[model samples]
Target: MDYLALLSETEQKKLLVNFSLMTDSSIFLLNENKELIFSIQAHNAQEKDNKSEIDIVDRDDANKGKGSISFSPNQKDCQRLLKDLYEQKVPFSCSYGHNYSLAGEPLIFHNNFLGVLLFAYPTSSTSIFTSQMKFLRQYLKNLFVCHYEMDNLSEEVVYNYEEFSLLTEISQLLGGILEESKICQIVIEKIQKTIPAKSIAVLLKEEKEDYFYLVAAKGLKAKRLIPEKINTQQGICGWITKIDQSILINTGQDFTSRNLKLIELIATQVGFSLGNIRLSKEREEILLGILDSLVATIEAKDPYSSGHSKRVSYYTQALCENLNLSEEVKKELVISALLHDIGKIGVPEDVLLKPGKLTPEEWKIIKNHPKRGLMIVKNINSFHNVITGIYSHHERYDGEGYPDNLKGEEIPLAGRIIAIADTFDALTTKRPYRKAFTVTQAFSIMAKNQGTQFDPHLLDIFLSCVKKGKIKKIN
Candidate 1:
């Protein structure tokens, strides 16, 4: 498709000069625009060309140069002749002014027109031209076709490499994503760079929903209003058709084929990514069932702690929302809160339900619950992030809490946020030893241990949420 654009000017001029030299016939090369790119005068037309200082007017630049015949053959007549010759698309014989006879041939590749080549000879040399014209025309056509094929091959290589490389990068990126909508957004954005579609959209169907929802939509033509949801029967096709009313616009058949292939590969990758996400969700649901059973056992053992983990999860989720955390991270933090006290399952029922304050010997066993919770779920693959909040919920902010005594920022963020939620629920809920602290009293108590027991910034946010009624009060 590049024609002479991809080649350097020196290379194009050298090519034309060689053709003129080898044939000993004056040659003029014009691109599809009818702009005279090169004009070399060979011995055949030299004497005639020298007779007049010819001023060939350029259609593009409005500058005057030599060669081609003239208001006196005009750019309009020249353009008309080039167009007509291309339509015929074969070597055409014609008179070049009154002094010389010329023949023109179309340079073509795969039914696509590249440009036209014109050879001129003096009228005195016309008798010797018929045989030379046929040979020279065919030779020039063959040469151009060969050059065109090479260009096509080179272009295709670069295109394929870029397409493969882009798809590979996209594949690696999609591998790490788990959300269905996120996968669609990422995949569609990559497709935009390689495809020439007017608009692109990824529509996904949920198993229980009768309509397809638009996941991501983009492109120059994408600004047009598109429905957010479409029923399955909305112009949906399951097969390819070859009807005349088809929406396909083929700018280049081969080029378009390659582009379509790129789209297909990307679509397949997205489908695989979506499939992986669905499977992951399925696995996660199954794992949550197991974690729920474990939490139920712990709650059943200690009635006072009933609904404690669930309340903590609710509060943690509220904090995540107020913090504007990403959905994925928020989801992890919430799950971690629900499973934070699961280690109590390993504590003896007599000690856990002891109706009175425990001694230091019993307190030592209570402190081991966080580490025990870690050991319980540590083997589970999907609960890796949940383990942190489970282990550190009891750890204080200063270097004085729990098995690790991690100071300041050494604690995981999930642990830090869950600590505030866990403490708030504990303070608000009734325990065997004392009545529940009112919301006002709970805040007053937590406010005193801002940095030593809780992260100061996070505690402030918790207080803000309660003030804004984002976290509902128990009192």
Candidate 2:
């Protein structure tokens, strides 16, 4: 929701002032981005005098006219304290001396972590003072959540059916449609419904390009004709592109302030949508790069399993497509399949490469791979959605699997899909102990254990796909 961007500098300052006055403690407010929005001294003159006597510089006074102050928690102890507060998303207090105590509360709005609000106070204060402050913090958090929700509701209520419809159309259009020209057309058409203009145009600047190209335009008279290419210094659109601002010119009729704000909002959304498209591509590339590196490392350790993960990923994706899974589900399945065997990296080389039957102890070690893979990827926030698949891919349909014996629909869909793909590849591809099986041989083996080892329904779909020549081969 871009919580930090929603609060104006003045609003932040006012909040700091109110917090200081109410708590009688010096306060520091930092946005979720860890940027210091502002700080305020205690409203108590006696405390201010005491702080002055101690020679602790009041950054608040020094930056009175500034929009925001960039103050780092330079001390290692303070830094660690802030890190704990951020990670825990809870209020914490620490004492530096008999009299001095530092307390921090994370500011949250609508379940979104917005920032941290730190209070510096005297430890000698009454217990009631601390309790009252805690109550106030809770009150503030609830107020912020309510305020944000009300603001959103107010925005929704402001729009009539036509206005709401136009916004909805634009939002849906911008969601997955990344083509710049198409997006510009949709945005312009939506805006035209609300604003009567002689002409409306969308100009975009390409990466590393010096000029803004007019991508979409409507209702242009000869006198109001826009140039095909606009210089960086030309026109309102050029200036907007140059500085990333949304400007509106009122020429045809008296547009309400709400209407103008809507135009600006649409412009801002357009810019954000374009930026997201680029970021999405970059994120996909980075995800693929990480997957390749991890898969390559796994393949390197097990020489006979080269390209095994990739093939599993391909097969899993094919199975997902055949099942008519959503794009998001297919993406996670592919990632989970590529790294399904990643836990084998932790198994002893001898255990992994053994050409004969393993001892019970060695087999146990092999089973620990899923748990190890979970540990390896658990810290990565992006992998949280797929970690279940990595950890439970070996689980059986009848609850006989390792790590967690989740049965039937209790198992995550990604995990269930990967289990089929993993077993299929293992049976069809030559492992150190066994020769590769033909497609028929693999299917027959899998079908025999369908209700026990695999989801019978998914297995049926997979076998049907293989028979139809949709999935070519395990390799």
Candidate 3:
């Protein structure tokens, strides 16, 4: 660690002041490159009174008017002494003249030479100096090492704290999002805040495609670069995408290993989030295809209701949109509508295709279709939200409905919406028992049973939709 680089200029000056008082000799502190950072002249009552006997000269004063001082030996004797000290890598003493003596010690840490600590004094005062003065010089050297080590430790503690804080913040940000593009964007933003970089990019492999595309980027013109898809066998980003690793490159500066590790952690998190989203979407598509096939089977048995399930799905979606339901809830409603009549497959063809009024027992068998539909999809995890809607779509709004006799708000909102759509589609479509009713006739019949057969608020919304020409009247 470079202790001088870690310390402020004020701290460096304070250190030099303390050393000057302790050594009773003028002090000079230099960097590893032999650049003088600070210098102080020792001034005490004893030194002032003995000024006549010792001619003290401060080399720094020669270039006081200049912004910086350059130290070089002008004499052959001084040059030889400096060379000897450097070769020995230890402290040594030499005379500037007959009266002045200078002692210098090489400041080394971890076997690396940092700079030198030099002290100047008068030779006439050598009789006053005893073994204690030599001991003081050694003590100062050890003290400097201790101070530098402590400074380095403090800096390390601060760096670790900042790293922990940054990781905590990024983890929280990643938790609230699910979209792959949004996740990539959030990761890149957090990285920009945590580290200094000229540019950052998140490359993601397109589904079933062999190349990676730039999904998110910062500080770089992405519009032009993103169009050219990058091959996984190409550059650093491509290599990282192939191996799921992260890298840091600095053009003219060196970054710490910790910074690289943090970037890798972010990349790993983004990759995991994207994988989960893609898997979920694939599973949802499969479930939707299954529902569509089941609906098709139900329609095939009854030719008059060829497009009944599709119409109910469209109506339920329109109702959900008017109610301002979330996308997730709207999706669930659409699936429930598509599979609402799926249980009719269990009903006998004679009763299902009867052109006359159904007997009481035949009517009871038709009501059992909802419960049968529930049993059909009960084992599927994705159908959890639609199961209740399928089972209760035929149940009346009042307590007079069949099966569970669920009353009022006791029915799921999805079940209630499907109930309206199912009735509306049945009334407007030509059935075995009756010809298709006109749009006004269907609405009038539904209006007569508002509070008893349908939700009052939902009924009003459906009526408003009819008036606005939003819901197309089926022939």
In terms of TM-score, the best-performing candidate is: 3
Which segments of candidate 3 are over 4 A away from where they belong?
1-92, 96-100, 104-118, 121-169, 233-245, 249-257, 466-475
Model 2 lDDT tens row, 1-475: 5555544445545655665565556666677766666556553412221123321333443234232222224444457768998999988888755544577888776578888876665556536458778667676767667777888888778665656677677887799876788888888877776776556788777667788788899887889787787787776755675776545566667677777778877877788888887787788799889989999989898899999899998999999989877778778888888888888889889989999999999999999999999999999877877887898898899998887778888988888899999888888898887799988999999999999999999999999999999988945
Error of 2 at 138 (Å): 59
Clashing pairs in 3: none
166: Cα error in model 1, Å: 4.3
Error of 2 at 70 (Å): 83
Model 2 lDDT, residue 452, Cα:
93
Cα-based lDDT at residue 399, candidate 1: 77
Q: What are the lDDT scores of the predictions, listed in order?
A: 0.74, 0.76, 0.73
Pick the lDDT winner.
2
Per-candidate TM-score against the hidden true structure: 0.72, 0.55, 0.73
The per-residue C-alpha lDDT of model 3 at residue 424 equals: 91
lDDT of 3 by residue, 1-475 (tens): 5555533255545655555555455555555555555555555412211112333334535224222222323234434645665678787877655444566767776788877655554555444433445665576567667877787789878977887787677667767565777888877887777787667777777788888787888787645455558887787756666776556566664566777887776666666778888888999889878978898899889999899999999999888889978888898999999999989999998889999989999999999999999999899889988888889997778978877988899988988899999899999998888889888898999999999999989999988897898877664
- Pitting candidate 2 against candidate 3, the one with the higher TM-score is 3
Candidate order by lDDT, decreasing, is 2, 1, 3
Off by over 4 Å in 1: 1-134, 165-177, 186-196, 209-211, 218-234, 238-255, 323-328, 398-400, 410-412
Where is model 2 more than 4 Å wrong at Cα? 1-189, 195-204, 208-264
